[model samples]
Target: MNLFAEIRALVIQNLEAMQSEGVLPDGLDLGNVTVEPPRDAAHGDMATNAAMVLAKPAGLKPRDIADALAGRLVADDRIVSADVAGPGFLNLRLAPVVWQGVVGDVLAAGTGFGRSDMGQGRKVNVEYVSANPTGPLHVGHTRGAVFGDALASLLDFAGHKVTREYYINDGGAQVDVLARSVYLRYLEAHGQEVAFPDGTYPGDYLIDVGQALKDKVGDTYVGQDEDVWLEDIRNFSTDAMMDLIRSDLKSLGVEMDVFYSEKSLYGTGLIEAAIEDLKSKGLIYEGVLEPPKGKKPEDWEPREQTLFRSTEHGDDVDRPVMKSDGAWTYFAPDIAYHYDKVQRGFDALIDVFGADHGGYVKRMKAAVSALSGGTVPLDIKLCQLVKLYKNGEPFKMSKRAGTFVTLRDVVDQVGPDVTRFVMLTRKNDASLDFDFDKAVEQSRENPVFYVQYAHARVNSVLRKAADAGIDTNATPDLALLDHPAELALAGKLAEWPRLVETAARSNEPHRVAFYLYELAGDFHGLWNKGNDETTLRFIQEDDHAGSVAKIALARAVAIVIAAGLGILGVTPADEMR
Candidate 1:
């Protein structure tokens, strides 16, 4: 299954054998030892730094340990040769059957072949796309939604119990602005025409909310003062906007396990309890912070306020939790929200925030650390902006969101699969350019298209094999799959499990997209290679056993591709349109 792991275990076993036989000293730390794919495939199948890692600690030369280790590794049936390269790296060439066996294992395991247990069932909460319930979700939230959903799926694939959460920003002044905007729309839905003033949402999306409000209550609150309708409309507009947001996310194949409201934290003693918990730890105090770095002294004046001792936990400076006006700052609700998450007993927490919120990461982490006493770790991943391109020009804004492209616009344009795949083509912290022209192209230049085409080609081969009456259900003569090209394809298949473990451990789901692309490239390369060599074709008229062997390898590639796409929330393509 995992040949690399199997070989590494062999290396460790032989090292222990060496120690017990008095060939080496006792109790050396083997934690740093690692076996991975060689940098250049032409050199070997796998390379380990066992010698380099142990040389200094064991008081021995790297070459000496490497040579001794190589001697023992060659005796294993799976290892064809083990040679020391560079100062101490052990380069290994595995037996042909070792790679062949990967195909059999994949067929037996099906699409679950590469699923890993690396997470050990740890509880992780992933909060993402917590955009304020003001209007529709935009392109930036789309990137966060795709990235966070894929990351949660990746963690789940690796054996973590993940909860997808959305924190509603309902307690902020923005919601009040939304209510004011919707009230104007309500007036517009009546006989009177209303103009949207500044500080109010003017997008066309709110017109329907206004119309719906008018439908529910006909002109009762139309002529009322702010006090008569602000609170009621605030609740009404937020619910409507959240319904719109939920529809947008569902369009992109994203769903949240929880939708926590900031309004619930207000006047409910939750914020007080959290701050009190921090106060008990001496983390809260009333103090005046010095002028922030790089700010003109006159630009920022000293003001006495309630501050959190974030500096004690790793923040650059103590952050104020309450303003001089005796009102809680925006950071207070966030701290309380995270405190609630910690009390829920999660092993870890991950927040996917926009890149503009990068400044908030350290302080948020500090709050979680102080509140949880460092028992729970909080990781905030900042997603950079997304730029849309069409016809060699920047795309226009959505009239619905006003000055931004909505998530519904993207999903409607490219469908969820292209939207999700293209969103993850870049790293979360890096800016992404979603080009309408490039995303749907049926060429290798487009990664999603290329990967999907590979899956489709594999399906084509299966259909062809079945039509030829080649007994597609027969067991493959895996040993017959010894051609260099065939074995290379299998070698790529063997990396799937390891890739899943590494990508999940790093919390980078983009790695899954990248790996799927590379696997597709390998599969495509083998498919093209079959054109010139009749023997390399997956379906052979003369040799049914040989055809079965090659079909096995092709099917394995498709299985891995589908599994990888599943983690990305992308549907595998059986045919390209």
Candidate 2:
């Protein structure tokens, strides 16, 4: 149960009571009222700005409203004391039993303790790692993949019908380059020496695709001209690259519900249909764009083109849909793709893009806005670069990937768990430094290790209790968990449900990682505290009931950590090696 929400409801109930009792005026909008954890735990268990927000509205003094509200709040059995702090902030400290209830709640709910229904089953499409199907995914795409996959999981936990999607950039020039590169490899497989030109991919990963093509066709297209092989090879190479990408993602524990082909939008009349939808709304026009800022008029050759009135829907300027040569511009297919998403009847849309695509955000949003007639909202999250370091120096690039580190390169080095956790240790928009040495380090400084150790420690406690013949399955007397350290951990556990809704509302899954770290800190803090205080030790030598209750509290922490880690797509460690 969400104690914060329950307390907020109590505060609202008391405020309405005060209004009826003439302590405050009627009809004050209580929407601004909020009950949250106090900034300082020393202040109280929860703090509310109800008095401060309603004071001016009710034509009453802040302290006067707070005093009246405090008296009414203490009448509830949960709240033991309500003290007014600076101005009109009311800090309420709940009874020990209230915090103790949190442990029992966590044990009962298990990993589902923090799952929320905030999204209310809304259909959401989260499109991420839509990298060009040219080669295996790189480090940049790795961050996007983890962020998007974790976000999809977080949304699902928060009660959204999330669709994990990967939009294949197979219809672009990049795929053509890949086809040519594979063609060169195909010639090499046919015993012909070939040199990769500057425009084609030179990665050794393509050597196998070339050899596979040779195996399939038996050099049928080895000496053929581009006209005969380009189309067939382009399709073949895209399928191969996508297969490699899928394998890379699967290795990292990321699986997409849909792998949408960009080629489907081309030749299927979808682009024209999407543009026509815009045209019907008067958002399409043929016009010459103004020369870009800082460009001299003589240096700029303005071309009249078919444009989408993106400026009407929050973009900086109108965008061209088709070029002067009458070929669809690069953005035309993206518009069609998003239009198709809207037509699929998703209540909301989320796109996880790499940081370089920051400029595309406004225009893509504008397209969805125009296509959905402002009905479906689009949220674009841009994941910044991930810098790899090892042994205090920059990590070397993958030879297989040619010039950059591939996702498999990172996952193979640290395994998927560490890779996933370390990737999310930073915010999506913030640049992350993934140090190979630091990621696997067994220290409090490493969040992944710290959080995992907490889970393993709990498991260790359970195992020790089991060996000692302690009946942990018996109903835990939560009331015995009255120590300050025990209560502090329960207090942290109580924040999970609230934190889940907050993170899902903002579309940030890194917050889950952050919260798990804090929870682990609280747990480890209590575990350490047991060293100096014999009464605080979880496994009481002579008291089975006491040990069971404390172990229950420790088990509760593991439950929430596993739940939080589950949302992050990282498996919890039963024992850290």
Candidate 3:
């Protein structure tokens, strides 16, 4: 149960009672009213802005409403004290039984304790890791992949029907380059000496794809001209690349529910239909874009192109959909892709893109707005670059990738759990410094290890209690948990339900990582305290009843930590070597 929500309901109910008693007006809007944990825990357990938000609307003084609301709230069984504070903020202290019940709730719910219904079963499509299939994913794409996968899991835990998707960039000139690159590799497989031209891929990963082609088609296009082999090789190479990409993602613990093909939009008239819809809405028009403000030259001339009125929604300027030569611009298929998402009947859409694609956000949102008629909402999250370090120096390129650090390089070096956890240690929009050496260090400096240690410590306690013959099945006597350290841990546990809703509302999965770290810190702090105080020890040598109660609390922390890690797609460590 969400204690914060329960208290907020109490406040709302009391305000409704105040309306009946004429202490507040009847038709006041209460949407902005909120109940949350007080910034200073010493002040109280929770605080509400019911009075401050209602004061101006109801034409009543803030203090007057707060005092009346406080009196009514304290009458509830869960509320031990409610005090009106500065500017009519009401701080509430819940009964000890309330904190005590959180342990039972965690045990009862297990991994599902913090799961929320904030999404209300709404369908959400989270499209991420749409890296061009011309090559294996790099470190930059790894962050986006982990972020998107975790976000999908988080949304699912928050009651959203989430669909994880990947958009293939196979319809562009890049894939044509990929086709020619593979043809060269295929020639090399036949023992022909070939030099990779400027635009052809030189990575060794394609060497296998080349051999596979030789095995399948055996001299069919061995010496054919570009026109004869280009089309067949393009399709063949992309399928092989996608297969390699899929394996790479699987290695990193990411699985996509859908892999949408951009090439499919070409032959099916989808791009034309998407643009036609925009044309029907008067959003598409023939226009000449202004030249760059400072770079307008004497020879600069206005060129007419088919543009989408992106500014009408929220973009800085209208964007081109088709070039002056009648070819669809790069933005056309993206628009059609989102339009397809809208047609799929998703209530919301989210795109996780690399930070370099920041410029595309506004226009893409504008397209979704016009296509969905402002009904469905789209949220674009851009993951910034990851700078890698090893031995306190800049890490060099991967030999296998033949260029930058591949996702597999990172995952193989530190394993999937460390890679996923470290990738999320920073906000998506913030640049992350991933140190291969420090990420694996088992110390407080490493957040992933620190958090895992907390889980491991909890398991250690359970093991000790079991060996001591303590009956862990006994119902925990939470009244015995009166120490301040114990209470602090309960307070952290109480924030889970609220934290899940907040993170989901903001669409920030990093917040879950941050919360779990803080929760782990509190749990560890409490465990460390028991090191000096014998009574605080989880396993009492002669007090089996008290030992069971304390073990129950430790297990409760593990339950929440496991649940949080589950949302992050990282497995909890029961034993850390």
Candidate 4:
């Protein structure tokens, strides 16, 4: 159970009682009232702004309301004391039994302890890693993939029905370029000399595709004109490139529920249907966009084009949907894609894009808004660049990927768990530095290792208790867990449910990583404190009941850590090597 929520219910109930007693007016808006952990742990277990928030609204003095509320709150045995802080904010110290019950709650709930129904079963579509099926995914896509996958899992944990999607950019001229590049490789497989001009891909990874094509059709398309092979090879190369991309994602433990193709939206009425929907709303019109702010009138060419009145929905300016030649602009397909998502009946949409696509956020959101008539909310998260370093120097490898580091390159050096956890250690909008040396180090400096070590330590404790014939599964005398360290660790455990709600609400899975680190730190601190204080030791040889009580707390730490790590798609280590 959420202790904070229960206490807040207590506060609200008391406020209602005060209304009946004429201490406060009836029908006061209590929406602004909030109960949370105090800023300073020493202040108390929880703090509420009930008095401060209601004082001005009720036309009453702050201290008078706080005094009345405090006197009523302490009537419950769970609330040991209630003291008014600055400006009539109420700080509350709950009885030790309250913190002790948190351990029991965790042990009882296991990994499901912190799961929330904040989403209320709403259908949320999270689209990420929409990389073009041109080549292997790079480090930039790695961050997006990890962030998106973790977010999807986080939303599911928060009780939303989530769909993980990938939009394939296979409908562009880039695929034609890939076909030509593969043709050159095909010629090479046929023992012919070939030169990869600037526009063609030159990676050796394509060598196998070329050889495979040679095997599929022996000497059929060799020495042919562009028309004979372009169509067939374009389709072939796209399929093969998509296969490579899928492998890249699989290497990092990512799997998409859908692989939507941009080309599929074409050769069909989908784009026209999406535009017609907007047209019916009077949002589509023929217009010319103004020139850029710095451009001279003489140098700028203003062409009349088919445009979408994006500003009506929230874009900075109107956007062109079609060129003067009646060809669809790049935006037409994206609008159709989101329209497709809306047609699928998702209650919300999320797009995880790279930082470079920040400019497109407004337009995409505008398109979705108009398409769904503001019924479906769209959120676009941009992942920033990742800079790799090692031993105080920049580390750049994967010559096959040319100038960039492929996702495979990173995963090959450090396994998928390290790669996934490290990618999430930073906020999606912030640049991240991935140091090879630091990531694999076993010390506490490595967050992945630090968090994993905590889980491992719990396992170690459980094993020791089992060998000593201590029945950890038995109901323990949790009331014996009154030591300050024990209480502090329990306090951290209680924050897990609250944290899950906050992180899910903010759409920030990185917060989970941060919370796990702090929780691990708290557990490790308590473990270390046992070195000096005999009473603080978890395994009390002479008192099996006391030992079981402490082990319950330790087990609860492992449970929460495992749950947090599960959202991040990292395995919790039973024992670290």
| After superposition, candidate 4 runs with Cα above 4 Å error | 297-299
| Local accuracy by lDDT, each model | 0.92, 0.94, 0.92, 0.94
Clashes of each: 0, 0, 0, 0
lDDT of 2 by residue, 146-249 (tens): 99999999999999999999999888888889999999999999889999889889999999999999999997896788999999999899899889999999
Q: Output the TM-score of candidate 4.
A: 0.98
Candidate 2 Cα outliers beyond 4 Å, as residue runs: 297-299
TM-score of each: 0.98, 0.98, 0.98, 0.98
Model 3 stretches astray by more than 4 angstroms? 297-299
lDDT per residue, candidate 4, 158-220, as tens digits?
999999999999888999999999999999999999998998899887898999999999889
State the lDDT at 144 in candidate 2: 95
Residue ranges of candidate 1 with Cα displaced over 4 Å: 297-299
Clashes of 3: 0
Instruction: Give Cα distance to truth, residue 96, candidate 1, Å.
Output: 1.0
TM-score, candidate 1, is 0.98
Alpha carbon deviation, residue 10, candidate 3 (Å): 0.5
Q: Write the per-residue lDDT of candidate 1 for residues 359-380, one digit (tens) a residue.
A: 9999999999999999999989
For every candidate structure, what is the RMSD over all alpha carbons to the true structure, in angstroms? 1.2, 1.2, 1.4, 1.3
